[model samples]
Target: MSDSEPRMIEILRILSQQEKPIGSKLIADELNEKGFNLGERAVRYHMQILDEKGYTERKGYSGRVITELGRDKLEKGLIYDQVDFIYSKFEEMIYLTDFNYITQRGNVVVNTSTIYNEESINILKSIIESGLSVSPYVNINEDKSKGKIEVTTLCGTTIDGILLNEGIPAQPQYGGLLRIEDYKPIRFEELISYKKTSLTPLDAFSSPNRTSVMDVVTSGDGLIPANFRLIPGIGREKTIEIIKKLDKIGIGGIIAISDEGKDILGITVPKGMVGISIVGGITPFRAIQEQGQEIDIKIAEEIRDFNTLSPITSTIKYGLKPVEHTPQPKISFLLSKSWNLIQQVNFDIEKRKGDIISNVSYLKKEDLDKTLGIMEETYNSNPKYINPYYKIVNHPSDDNMVGIATICSLSIDGLLINNGIMSNPKYGGLLELTEPPLFIELISYNGSTVDPHKIFIAKNMTSISGNFGPNKILASFKEIPYIAREYAVDLLDTLDKIGFSIYKIGKPREVTYNAKAENYNFGVVAGSGLNSIAAVRERGVDIHVKAIEQLMPFENMDRL
Candidate 1:
């Protein structure tokens, strides 16, 4: 219900209430009357942008009228505003009230201001017992002072937009604070690789039976699918079924990033929705659909074929009025407050990893289950029932064997960490993945001994190279072995000779180098001895035998 963007809504609303085309001056005046204080010039500027954007129209110099796109924008704004209002009221109630005692799952505890009348308490009790969520609450302490009350609720009244499933609603909402007790996290070094095959919309429609606009755009190779469901006329029941099926296959919950280009939720899977079916050629029910324009399958397919950035491209080609930008909004059952729970859960998970060794192996399901059950019983018996965290891992023996590692952990932020679970006492405990930079370091060392700090030093070298150049330009730099400094210079010099471009070089002592012509640029730092060379490699510096030979001129000579 939050208007992530609000100004656009305000502009649309002003145009909606007017019958005839109104000039920007009048709109500005109306907004000023409503406390916006926008000058006519600024309003006119926004009006022109909106008109060009297709949200409004300039009719014969009369001014601007709300286009169908503008109306759609306004309608969505109202819905978000209403939802925000409800959530704000709920927050306000929690902030102001205090409860003397609060009970959850029959565990009663005292709080600051639990003085609500018996009837009010009972009303809440009924709602909770009926498997429905309640607004935020307050707790009063024994001293009649307020106590801490943490209230949470899921964002929906239904499961997959259905009030009932099999004649019963999904009560005891599944979207509450992720119970850390529910899942187990298995750790496997193999799962750490990012080569796993995952499903996408293209995969969904590439089969012989499916006909998606994505198929048309990429000649059945499948273009990036749009999240909007513009197909039209999809029945509620069918949508519900689709949602459940998608959930089972783990294809749902992907969110497109916001305009700010930050992924706050961390789930970065992209999704393309199979939009509403355009059956019977009736007007589409979606807000983005034009109010009176009849749409057939062809028009719907054309619209679906366009990507998010070019939403109106096909429509313009067809001489249709542009629709509002209608990318699918992120829909989540969990509320924002779950973020706090996620932080706590992640902390706990890190803490639990302290002494437990991770195992990576393919074991018979029964044997693996027995070992994990024993481990859980020994380590996590206090929490009688917890959720299992599925950690998918690649098998060491078989690249084709992908195993799910099940361990216990909390899933507050709607993501599951892959952990490998199979442990064999005979196979010498479990395998765990090292830190990301450490893994990169291992590769650079080429199975040779390298200090972990080499990776950090290498990354730091890259950072320094970005702003600082060779030693002459820097006023001061750390002093390291002279050989280490020479190694960096020789590496840069050799790279330039052997098809690599060297753009900059730092002083001989604290050697810093930047490469430009490679597929990717790399930086080198030369302060520490072997560690410095190792660090540069970890930081992505590719070296050749010629560079190594030049850097270590005495390598072929025997030591006295």
Candidate 2:
């Protein structure tokens, strides 16, 4: 049980005694008089915790009343119910103790709190965004810490009344939070340029599909087929399945930006949802009708058809409310003082990229494993990273495949990184990335190159490959160079920051100029030099800045 466990249970019992909804302030006064000596903060905390799970029935900004569940728990503990640990993080908790003494100064009595979850307590807030309710949890046979029962709500908990795949329940997953590096990131070229035909909407909607809303949205073509409100408690997979069906029927490619501005997709794909309402009629339950006034489905469909900012489904109710915002008060599960363990990556590597020749496994952390006993999900492996060498010039076969490992920067959401450090290999291998910007330097007299630097003091001249100004005489910034003077302007000027820098040498001499704009398709004048990009007639040049960024290791050389 949490340190506040006993007090919380006591608060719930008191609130349940109230016949009508009681204000947070009143609860504080009641607790105070009982010699229990709790503040309004504790009063509100108890109510919030209880109400979130349908235990207490919280009336709007008014007060709270004991709900059936609240009465049940108040009379008989929820001994057999299992809480679906839908949310994974614990650090983001915002603890607020019942402390309302200051509010009584003027008698209005505003309540204050004192909670001790993780700092920055990032509570994974979930609410009903909108849509029909479905099974929101996977219901495994796992039981977490029992020292303190973890009570949770599984009702119509949606993000903003807008349910995606029903509801993204708060189940913690082992190796979840995807360390980004796990999935293969296909480039625009790779994703689009494939020989595989673009699957038609019907073809893309596989019977056994497993993708996200956006994926289905992207594959869709015309308008949403139906407008309906979803009930809470549905799972995300079901929502995705619904989207897949819409895609099959043909949906307009999501307005990369527009939803409320279009027909049949108003306020869709919300960045953040407080709650959701739909225009259509209340989803007729299997056995009974719903409580709220039945909404106008025809109006909603019209709004959707007209592409109004308000989707038809939203006309169903007032803006949706948060799940935790519910009122009521009874709890048996205490979010234990400590959380059940999930998994961890313990690093054993020292900083510094010793030597490339030496076989060194860049990562120095032990591999993580499954924690199904604790967290609810599994982590997908296969970290992706960038391989700059794969795309180097003169290495035509290189693909410049991207590679990098993905890992979460957060520990437990409720617990926070209070006791650990988040580490990544790239940051750990900083020294190797900029070893003085690698390049080859030339010796003046010997004409031999060692250090990655150059002093281009051509005694004669130089010739550049690739095309020139319609075969026109090569002219300097001021005059044509018939007898080019050998001056080391910058040898590795061809390379950019990714490599060495350019330098000059001693004495002035003339040399045949034969330099080529290695990767410039936009046409090169004076400063234009070879780049990481190999000029070709295939695809035209890209954004100028991007081309240059690809080239590095600019060096300088001097001749004898």
Candidate 3:
């Protein structure tokens, strides 16, 4: 294949995206915009050759359109001639990325995945919330009649673009599956060098049978798609600084940076070069595929204004609402409302539980204020391990006393129940501090009228005071029907985004973090909502404690 054939192929690609015939001048302009240095005369020469070969046909004087053969050729052209095709496209997108970290403006390259169903959208959002994607921001387009949804996500090459804009000469090396254990990247499980492949390596590795991104999202142990890049040793510090800035603006995917002359994840680095591992942008779609959903993906498909993308949380909060001028199907509209109703019912159940607990247990206003302060301090000290939702209400009996409501582990049970999964509260226990943690003491929630966390706290069974010796924290155990594992994992991920401290969701009929499940049920371990109050009590504050407290609006809760 001649050099001009590649240019003609590009022209065919441009024509494929157009709905009508386009002239050579317009094709030349588009080519130039994409960094191809073709002029009208040169493009006309390519088009004449394309027509002679029957790959494209001239439609009267209007212009030319790609033939059926042209579309096939575009997809299945000579492999040897396109040796570094993906590499070149990667470079082009990097040059095109203009996202300014400081001003938070300009265009960024994005990858789009089109799926045929709505269920996959939720799975994609959960993956984004798990932080496996290049950025948390995403753009979604839904067409219910066609049963299609297009998800546009930030591509990892955008980092390369930013690095280039900052005068750092970074070279993409390979795309691979990065092994993660306990949520830390350990090594590259498989790698394909960019110079050796015409196809996008990450995309080739994105099959459901190949990648374990969903496992990583749920258990923090599995392989995730990632990329390797290298920069000059002198630019190490500057690269790190830029990455920090990107993180501040919610675009995070830089896994690790190697020291000068050092290799990353056992891959050799050339002398005077530094390696950087980045999470691949195709992760969410990879996760969608893992759940047995089919998707058509395009890598580095186009550039869009950064302002047009919204955080993935928005999609989770608001389901596929109709885009402007696009009518939402009646069934789709009903499904969206049903999802919202499920969330509302779950919250209402918890709120009712809290109201019941509040009726019997009331704290003096002074005590309530102090308890809130203590809970805030505990959360501030370690927000990751603590629950952040609470409610304070006027006492029904005494004006001087107030009602304080905190999230209960039973809320997890309620969430599972609302989603059509039967959940049984097994035990409330003292989880001994360890790598995976262990339940040292347990009380049966079915037999006990009082919440077990409250019982354990009153009996001085918990030692979660100063993070010293024999440390134990509050946790609860529940079991869900074994068949509900997949649905439950997705639900737990959604709950995780909304401030639920879910510790571990177990495999079928197995022990999760040392707590066994029933024969046909899977175990779930969650942080007790009363853990903070336990800390307050440990501090010797005079506080009335109620576990499984009724529901409070999550948005109304204050953060420390």
Highest TM-score: give the candidate number: 3
- What is the C-alpha local distance difference test score of each model? 0.27, 0.22, 0.72
Model 1 gets an lDDT of 0.27
Q: Positional deviation of 84 in candidate 1, in angstroms?
A: 4.6
lDDT of 2: 0.22
Residue 50, candidate 3: alpha-carbon lDDT: 89
State the lDDT of candidate 2 residue by residue for 300-349, as single tens digits: 00001111111212211212122222221311111111112112222112
Model 3 ranges with Cα > 4 A deviation = 1-4, 17-20, 26-45, 314-560
Backbone clashes under 3 angstroms, per model: 59, 128, 4
For 1-560, candidate 3 gives per-residue lDDT tens digits of 24575687789889998999999889999999877899999999889988998999999999999999888777645333343566787887888888899999999989998998878988887877766778879889998888898889998888999999999988998777777777767777666566634446675465446678888866777888888999999999999899989977878777778878866675677899998888888888888887888899787888889998988773221111111222222111111222333344344332423211111235677776677787787777666567877767777778888766666666667567766887777766677766667665554454332455665676556665574433678887788888888888888877776667788888875556656676888888888877777787787876677654344555455454
lDDT of 1 by residue, 322-382 (tens): 2222332333312132223323322123222221111122333433344344323322321
TM-score of each: 0.21, 0.16, 0.53
C-alpha lDDT of residue 469 in model 2 = 9
- How far does residue 287 in candidate 2 sit from its true spot (Å)? 35
TM match of model 3 to true structure: 0.53
